[model samples]
Target chain A: MDAIRIDNLTKYYGTARKGIRGIEQVSLTVAQGEFCGFIGPNGAGKSTTIRTLLGLIRPTEGSAQVLGLDIGKDREEILARTGYLPSEAMFYPGMRVRDVLKLSADLRKKDCRREAATLCERLQLDVSRKVEELSFGNRKKAAIICALQHEPELLILDEPTSGLDPLMQRAFFEILRERNKAGVTIFLSSHVLSEVQRNCTRAAVIREGRIVACDSVEALSRTSAKRVVIHGRVDLGLLSGVRDLEETQESCSFLYSGGMKELLAVLAEGEVHDLSVSEPDLEEIFLHFYSRKQ
Target chain B: MTLIKHELRQGRISLVVWTGAIAVLLVICLLVFPEMKGEMKAISHLFGAMGSFAAAFGMDRLNFGTLTGFYAIECGNVIGLGGAFFASLIGISALAKEERDGTAEFLLTHPVSRAHVVTEKLAAVMLQVIVMNLIVLVVSLLSICAIGETVPWKELLLMHSACFLLQIELAAVCFGMSAFLRRGGFGIALGLTTVLYFLNLIANMSEKVKFFKYITPFGYCEGVDVIMNGGLDIRSIATGMLFAVLGIVAAYKMYCGKDIR
Candidate 1:
């Protein structure tokens, strides 16, 4: 069963100069235990979509369902079972980290302080200091703890890894993967590609309030042909025989639309001592999705 | 901590400052004003001066010079008007500051419901207003006792308690307005409080506009009626209670659907 199902969700934000339209006709479904990333640029409706799913803002049109509960009608029940890590957000400057966690625990009707402590230790977050005393990175970690401590069935995180150092970012994704192994579903939103590529099994790309593409990372890359790089003092134009040729002065690479047979003829004649042919990673596919050709 | 405690803590330093000022001012009014009394004509002339201000603050509900009259004017005029302003401003800020500071995102992502967040914050404002009123009452009574003057206990308690309710009822209105206006909570709270103050003015100015008595909690908790003549008007008390209930209901309903941003 799909853990979340969003159907034609649209949100319109009124403003003086061209209002922001978020997630127009955006629809997708994530199966239970799958880790999915919703990747987009800033103001591309990532946060708005997530907020709508959480029932923070009503959709201008359509609906979403989380764990079989309607997004609009069953918000409290849905929220009760879900963990969320909002992007950079505010905490009472006066609230101690422990107190913030305790307050959340009280509201959720659960005591995950021990688990929160464990997560903090694992994330290298200090639970002793007040929220105000923490740096941005530490604050995000604190928010992460509050979201994950509840043992929720689903985790909805908006730019969850933002403000974290590289080490913390990796640790966060590792934690997310481990949680997914425990049968938790994750819907993560981010603009950064590396984090999503490293953690997500699949992702959907949203552009200008509409989903432009959705697929497994591997399939999305495979759909573009293999890219071969001959990084050297080599003339990039020489590799033009290969399909989807793209070059920058000294080096050249191309998306090999055909099989390896086509690459051998082109490469055999060149001083390609160093050559590499690999399936395009998510980053390249994401570029292709957002590239001008689209 | 709930938003209430968080807010109360934020306002504590200001709370102390404001409350202390109120206490000192009331004590001074009690201590110095009595000795400065002159002839009956002079007293009546003085009452006339106080009455204009009283009428502005809706304190002419009784004769201005008697003990009950004095309590209504001093406590009701100063404490009542001032407390309503404090409570409404504090209440509105408490409700909307989370969003303004970008903290609502932080707080709302937790498993907590919005209802808990709002209710807890409002509870804190209630406690603050109570504390402020208590300071005035404590200072007023101590000053009266130290001066060896008698106070009508029943009327005094009724009037002060009514003052407390007036401030709280305004807080409820501010709290409700916060949910709908979000960023505009402060403006709405201030504007409504001002409008209600005038509505009470209009309600008192004539019998024709007395229908406005239903609109202003200040009118319902008329300081003069409670202070001078006797007990509170039950019908007016019911009206204040009704507005309070309505305010809470509106806050909860509007907030449940409000965007946390």
Candidate 2:
């Protein structure tokens, strides 16, 4: 069974204008034990989709299910099995980190003391400090502990690494990898493409409230266009699979997708001052998709 | 249950401060009652000349000579205003605090449903108001005894009960209003309570606006009316209860469907 299934889910923030889309007909599915990444720029409906899945905001239309339970009708049951970390970590002020974790366990009706202690130790979190006294990274670590202590079947994280240092982020991803190995499904939303590329097997790129691309990481990388830059004026306008072509007095650049041998032969015909060919990064690929749509 | 415990712990300081303030005011008023007892006639005539002021505050109907009458006129105002403000403050912050503190996403994503959250928060606020009223009750009883005044049990119970009901009604109204606010609602709560009190005052001062008494919770808890009639007005109490129920129902409806942005 799929861990999460959303069909034509849409949300319109009615207060803004007549048709300001929070998300428009967003549909996707994550199979059991799958690690899925949701990538988007700010205000691109990534958080909206996560919030809708958690039943924090009702959908304007369409339907969703989490862990095979209806997102609307079985929200309590779904929430019981799903753990979430919001983009901004907030806790009750004047409470110790331990107290916050304890409160979360109490609300979930679970005895998570052992797991919470283990998580705190692993994350190097100080459980004795008050929530308001903790720095942003520490607070995020505390939030991570709260979300993971209950051993939920599914973990939904939104921008979970925003406040963490590079070392802490590495540790956090390692922990998530271990959890995923233990048969826990993961849905992570982030704007950083490299982060998603490092951790997620499948990714969905959303742009302006729509999914621009959704595919496995390997397939996406294989199909992505390559960046080619040439100097010394080599292009004679005879190259196939060369689109988005640009020319200058001393250099030419374009995205190439055809055979590499033919391209090298074309480049060898000219006096090449410099040449570079590399796989496009996710940002470039994302921009390609966005520009093509326009 | 966890939510309730969290709310109680969070509200402990506010509960202590409001209860202590009201208790101190009640004690001071009870202590001053004795000095004025012998000068009742002159004081009544003095107040009588200021007809509008006397009637607006219910001093015209209550005699300052008798202990119950003095308690009705003095201690009543203290608890009435103090209790209403306390209840309003508590109720207004009950739901809005989640948003103001940026904790709505944390709480709403838990295993509990939105309806459960509303119920638990309302229960906590109501519990706080009850505890505050109970403390005031004990303080009033002890202060009256310290003054060597015989307790008029029935009238005392009636006045306290009326105050209790008034506070609950005010809390319900403010609780409903809090669902619509995204930030702390101190101003709105205080404004609503003050406006209702003044509406009750206008109802008392002018015969033309007498119908305003039915609309304000303050009208149902009139200490002079409770003292003179020896009990609460059943019809007014029923109206107050109806408003309270409607307000709570509306709050639940709005909160359950509200988008936690």
Candidate 3:
């Protein structure tokens, strides 16, 4: 069974005429034990989709199910089996990290003390310090520990690495990888393409409140259009199958989908001052998708 | 249950401060009762001459000579206003604080329903108000005993009970308001409490606005009314309870469907 299934889910804030689109008819599914990445720029409905699936915000239309349970009807039950880390982690002031974790464990009715302590130690978080006293990165570490301690079946994280240092981000992702290996399905939402590319097996790209593409990471990369930048004088009509072409006095660049050997031959004909050919990152590919309409 | 415990811990300082202030004020009011006892007749005559001012505060109906009467007039105002403010502060911030402090995402994402969140928070607020009232009751009893005054247990219980109801009613109203507020509602809660108290005052001061008494929770639990009638007004209490229930129900309805941004 799919871990999450959203059917034509849409959310609009305020009235229809003047309303802001949260997400429009967004549909996707994540199979059990799969690590899925949700990629989008800010205000692109990534968090909205996750919040809707968690039953934090009711859909304006359509519905969703998590762990095969209806999001609206079985929210508490689904939440019991799911863990979430919000984009901006916040905790009640004056509480120690241990106290926050204990409250979460108590609410889940689970004995997560050992796991909590272990996660804290692994993240190098001081559990004795008050929440207000902790720095941003430490607070995020505390939030991570809280979300993972209960051993939830599904983990939904939104921008989980924004405030972390490089070392902590590596540690955090390693922990997630370990959890994923243990059969915990993860849905990680991030604006950073490289992070998603490194961790997720499958990814969905959302733009302007719509999912423009969803595919396996390998398939996405294989089908990705290459970005070619050329310097020195070049004939404008030499290339075919090039999209998003742009030219300047000294250099030119375009997204190339044509054969590489033909493009290299064309480049060799010119006095190449400099040349660079690289597989486009998700961000560039995302821009390609977005610019396709124009 | 954990949510309740968390709320209680979070609100501990406010609870202590409010209860302490009320208790100290009540003790002071009770301590001065002995000195005023000898001049009660003169004081009563002076208040009688004040007419409208006396009526506005319900002092016209209550006897100032007896200990219970003196206690009702002096200490009742302190507890009434202080307790209402405390309850309002708690209720107004109950749900709103989670959003204002950006902690709703943490708390609401747990394995609890929105209804569960509302109920647990309301329970915590009720517990705080109850604890505050209990402290006031105990302190009042101690002060009465220290002053060598015979305990008018029935009247004392009646007055305190009425005050408790008034506090709870105000709390429910403010708690309901909290659901709709994204930022803190301290100003609104305080203003509402003050307005309601004045509404009761207007009702007492003039016959034209007597109908306002039915609308204000304070009208049902004014100390002078409780002291003179020797018990709570059953109809007024029922109306106050109905208002409290409606406010709580509205809170649940709005909060359950609310979109936490």
Residue B236's lDDT in candidate 1: 73
lDDT score for residue A118 of model 3 = 87
**What local lDDT does model 3 show for residue A243?**
79
lDDT of 2 by residue, B54-153 (tens): 9988888777778987888888889999999999999999999999999999999999988899999999999999999999999999999999999889
- Model 1 chain B: ten consecutive residues of lowest lDDT: B36-45
**Residues A1-294, model 2: lDDT tens digits:** 999999989999875336579998898998899999998889999999999999888899899999999998999999999999988899998789889999999999999999999989889999999999999999999999888999999999999999999999999999999999999999999988889888999988888888878888766776648888888868556877776678899998887877888898888888799988877776666666656644
- State every prediction's TM-score relative to the real structure: 0.84, 0.94, 0.95
Q: lDDT, candidate 2, residue A72?
A: 89
Q: Which candidate's DockQ is highest? A: 2
Q: TM-score of A-chain in each prediction?
A: 0.85, 0.88, 0.89
Interface RMSD list for the candidates: 2.3, 0.6, 0.7
Give lDDT tens digits, candidate 3, residues B99-123: 9999988888888989999999999
What is the number of backbone collisions in each predicted candidate, taken in the order shown?
A: 0, 0, 0
Q: Please give me the total number of clashing residue pairs in predicted model 3.
A: 0
Classify candidate 2 by CAPRI docking class. Answer: high
